[model samples]
Target: AEKGTDRSTLMDILWDVQRRKRYISEDDIGKIGQAFNMSKTELEGVITFYHFFSTTNRGKYTIYLNDSIVANQSGRKAIQRAFEEALGIKLGHVTPDNMFGLYRTPCIGLSDQEPSCLINFKPFTNLTRDRVFEIVTELKSGKRPSELCDIPKSIIHYTPAEERTVFFKPYRQFSSLSILNTYSPEEIIDLVKKSKLTGRGGAFFPTGLKWEFCRNNPSEIKYIICNADEGEPGTFKDRVLMEEHPELMIEGMIFAAYAVGASEGAIYLRAEYMYLRDRLEELLSKYRSQGYLGKGIKAKTPFDFDVYIHMGAGAYVCGEETALIHSMEGKRGEPGTREFFPVEKGFNDRPTIVNNVETLCAVPRILEMGISKYLSLGTKATPGTKLFSVSGDCSKPGMYEIEWGMKLRDFLDLIGAEDPCFILFNGFAGECLSEADFDREISGENLLAEHMQFRFKDPLEYARKMGGIGLRSGGSFMVFNKQRDLLKILKNVADFFVAESCGICVPCRTGNFLLNKKIDKLILGHAEQQDLDEIKEWSNIIKITSRCGLGKMSSTALNHAMLKFPEVFEKRISANTDFNKSFSLEGATADYDRIINEMTLDYD
Candidate 1:
């Protein structure tokens, strides 16, 4: 009962119920719904929207194995089989003893260390078949997964000395806060503007501009939401920032609160990072004790601000600011059509400023280091260093602090990319580039230009007219060597979008499903040139009509792949155009047969 029954606290209360019971039973849900004044249907919708929350029993120790493309490339199938063998249960089933449940989940922000799983929400990385057996054995012997798994360290590489690094530098406690006392809200915004910092969370919106807009809003109660929902597959840089340098992010949020006159703030952490919740709460408590947070922080200013940690169950669409606010309000995590921006109407109809983990973490460092020094780090158009989660076909697959304007070729060399042929600049929702585009510079200038050009015309035509691909990344740099099957990778990416789509709009829901089917056709050598044309046509429809970024960019990697490597698809296309010849009757009836057999067995 410590957790209030208010609608706002529904997520927190549900998390408690899930933890205590291992699943939210119907009786528990009824009680929660009555207390929160919600309907059973509404509560069930909320529960089913998130990947982590479930209504059925998930056994005492649940294992969510990562099934991302990178995980498969790193022998995830073998490790999965080992876990099944050790546990004596099939995937997606609980053991007869109910001591273990195995399930497959999307990427948990651990691409660098593939073949990973969250056993009771604690990450166990770089799993081999032998390691899987040992882990199951340990669990059977009453060993806690937490006791066996150490906190995963940030595998940052190809960076300069710690002193030179922006985030990893030695931090003086409350240094930025002390500086905040000297400046007005206007001055703080101006400093950020002069520094030329953009949102590092893929949108690339001007940081200072966003703050100014929020500060200008007339709402008395404003909010500062640090978007810690780093659900983008192949991206874990935010995870490192939150784990190692959460203080910086907290201080940054305090700075934002001071600027925008926000009394309360929250860190909407993703469910995958549930392990870090306790440590973060402890840090917040410590800050309160030391006067770095709470009313009249440090007793030198009029600011009255405090921040809380809000846990996300698991919805990739919640990474969008609108969907995030809806989730925070104890509603289904669905994106709303933006009649007004978040800065105008957000988080219970109050003015809100939503910044990503990297954007906020940089705020304190920018103030502490001064504008000139921060601006000197990267190109003039896009100043400051960005943390990239580098993985796939690299000798060093981890985090790297790269400045803007670095050539794609240079970055590949720095990361020791092994015969890199294709690269996914961001996550699946971002662009794809081939070796021919290596000379392009990774900067905001090209990205902004590309955005403007792609808004009205075809991206492939624009690329052809410009003579090459433009480079822009949201800090995910996944390199694929020649040995990697591009079609298989595309199929995995298609599957991720299908599973993660929130299904609020018809375009996103149906488009992703149809796109996945088309990708399967291509992979199976049943796709003809007409199928390729239909893929492009469907991709355009999804991009143009989709309500949110998820549907809009769901086909981005597929579109880019077809453009960059036409030969890959061309080779797979069958000469026969007859749809009847390609159709498989047995394959279509496989699910029907399985369901009938299961029903017969239950009756017997």
Candidate 2:
């Protein structure tokens, strides 16, 4: 109760209660609601929207096993079996002794090290069946998960000195802030514009233009938000940036604050990265002590900016800016209408500038290196290097810093992708590419120009005409060898979207569910040519009609794979034309029967 009853602090309070008591009880909810002047239903809605917060007892140790496709490929089933055997309880259940609870969650940004889990939010990576058994034994012996965590200090691949780019290069403290007084805010924006830096979060929006819009707003209160919610499956570059170079990112936020005339700022760290919170908080305190943050920062000009960390409780849709702002205001993280961008009305209805972790990390480096040096690194259209989170079927599954326009084939070679047949670029929400398009370049210019030309038209036609994939990625490059089943991968992607959809709009909510059903049909050898046609039709509708990026691009991988690898789907089609032969009543009712059985068991 001492943490003040502001609406913005509701998430923090809920997190605190959950950590202390292992669950938010009915009495706790009533007390919190009374303090915040919110109803019980409203509080329950907020709590249920996130995956991490629980209303039931989660026991002493909560284990969230990663359910990404990479994890499955790397023998997740065996590890899961080991945990179940060790704990003597199935997933989604607490042990009878009340010592542990096991659950499965989506990607936790540790795709490079598959079969990983977060025990009390502390990541334990690169797991095997034996390792899982050992971990469970140690935990039973009263060893803290934090002490037994095997997460690597750095997952970045070690490249030669010459291969190192802007982000991975050696850093100096406050190098950019030391020169903040030299240029006016407009000049600072101009320098960023000249550098041609775009949003590294995959939208590719001009960073300088976004800052310019926020700065041009006449609001007295402004906000600078660092989007550290790296929730996309197969993407973990932002996590690496936060772990290795958080100060640089914070400095970039300071630069944004100075440019946009904002005083308050925040880092929206995702719940998966709860482990990074203490270290980041310590860094923020050190900066404040060193005069790099807090009021009258560095005692320079009259401008003052301070930043705090806001934790996300596991909503993938919250990665969107409007949803993120809504989450910050202590509401369900749902994307609001885009009548006005966040720059005009955000964070309690004020001007706000939101930048991803990689985008912000580059800000201080760009200022330090100057425009000419930065621009000369990448292509003319998309200047500056990018961090690619390479994983899945690669000998070197880690973060790779490279120039923007590198070829897909070259990247595969560099990462030692063994007999790569398919690559899911960007993410599940992004496109899939086959070996036929290996010559295409990875640059924002292709995606931007193609988007301008096509503008909701047929992307497959654009690919054929341009002889390129023409899609910009958010730096998740997951490769798959020929030995892997594309259908299973497609099923995983479908399930991810279905699980993560915010259900705000009809198209995304229904479309993802239907898509997953179709993929299941194909996997079971029950899909017909008609199902394939319907899949394409539904995918197009979801992309065109969905409200936010999550819904809009939810079917991208399926669409791309259908267009790129027609043979994969063709072979899965059922030969029997009779509906009675293809469809099994028992199979169709299995899910319903299972749900009823589980509910009856709980009642008993």
Candidate 3:
């Protein structure tokens, strides 16, 4: 190997890795070393810096169990216990027979999804322990499993691109190494370098890149946090993952902790996830008992790590990473400026890495599949599969694991969107899509490469111009049927933004109140152009000057809707409509009086 340079791709090295020991060769190490102009040991150092690489052969049939509140509340633990009892194996251990390996994943936030399992990489929802046992028994007996339960079929396949494009589906090569085994940090980082999986949370940051940042930071104590609080109005993917495969998530957490040199981690679930909290506690106890956690994890491994759960009081702002960290510190949830990146300053003023449930869960897979395999799956920028919480007007709305480059029409077809409806990315509680402007590819990174297409002129134009919402912001898709009232929806949304203003920013608090009143006047058929201008002005000001992304983006929800569907607002304020429906000026006085009286105390 020359010190100056060499011409070899990562794929060449990865192939060498795949060719060794009936699996891949460790010689892939020297290939990468030669390419990067470094020694093999240096290449190994970089590989061990992250949590997405694997060094061992794993079982053919891999079982990823999600243990979170949504599933636990729906009774996932009992199902897990049943699976363990039936298999006569522990939760996180693979069987000696290599028939199966079970690991828990943190909440993927598919709350409506019943207890679930990932069978041979395909998600099987609405499951129980008996159901899992039946599937396992059938697979073991070499018998095609019976038409067991009503697990809904989804067209969303989440394999690497080569696998997706390979038409001649040879019988799956059931290799023990195909299943992800224990991974070292360097291996995880190398795998990530290969897969190119970005975070599944709203921001869509590169998972590998983030690990690199935290790893390189000169901090004594780095921290990684898993944000499981699924409080977005129509988003619930995280909750589902927690309930169905808690340990898979735990594995992801452990992987992250190892990658970033973090000793402690926390899963922040919303207060509504009480069941998930309890289940996680039980799983943690099991892992600790097995010595998989605490001071020394992985057979006296020098790396030290532990995970804990923190329940949030159900504030939407807590979804923001900064706010969640603050709340985890026992303070009111509110976001601060992103002046210093969390990679530099986080938990206890240490460098921190915060990722959502789905992002981390993808770690084990990326490690097993390799970076190039992961990169081949989705769009160029948005590589790897994504978990989506589909709610609202669509038929069979639930959590889906889809490729990033998939089309909206394709998604609609997959979910049976034969009827016309509005598409809302993020949440119905977030933004509403009237035209297909948002109908482009659903990968945030890819979309950013094309430049963010935010402002829209009209609904029809929007559809034509919309490339796609970037995947970084937790690639969520919500559909609203025509039966929904657009104006009424916007009004409700505005009211919510006003109510949840936190009273920290004066412009947000007062301006939102005025905007609410302005909407009321418009709805009451007493509005003017001047009023509309004022509402827009105030909303714009608040949008520009808010303290956090929440306050800043809050106005966009309504403003976007107004631009896309102004007719809905105008039509709702007809002279024939009931004006009283718009406001309750008189009732407000009585409500305030009641509040004042309730706060009053008698001398007696």
Candidate 3's C-alpha runs over 4 A off are: 1-187, 299-301, 428-430, 445-472, 572-604
Candidate 3 lDDT over 567-594, as tens digits, reads 7666644553443454668777998887
Candidate 2 wrong stretches, greater than 4 Å: 158-164, 447-472, 574-604
**TM-score of each predicted structure versus truth:** 0.92, 0.92, 0.63
Better by TM-score, candidate 3 or 1: 1
* lDDT by residue (tens digit), candidate 2, 1-604: 6879889999999999999888999999999999999999999999989998999999899999988898899878888898999999999999987789999999999988887899999999888888888998999899999999975554576343453378986787777788687877888899988887777776666689789989899999999999999888999998888888889999999888888899999999999999999999999998889887888864235588899999999998898888999999999998876766788788999998889999999999989888888888767787778888988998989999888777778888899999999888888878787888788776655533454333436532443343212334578889999999999999999999898998989999999999999999888877888999999999888877777888878888898899998988998874444445556788999999999999999999
Across residues 314-403, which tens digit of lDDT does each residue of candidate 1 receive?
Answer: 898898888999999999999877666788899989999999899999999988888888788767677778789988998989989877
Q: How many angstroms is residue 215 displaced in model 1 relative to the true structure, after the best TM-score fit?
A: 1.0
| lDDT at 171, model 3 | 26
| TM-score for candidate 3 | 0.63
C-alpha lDDT values of all predictions = 0.84, 0.85, 0.60
> Candidate 3: lDDT of 596?
75
Order of models, best lDDT first: 2, 1, 3
Clashes of 2: 0
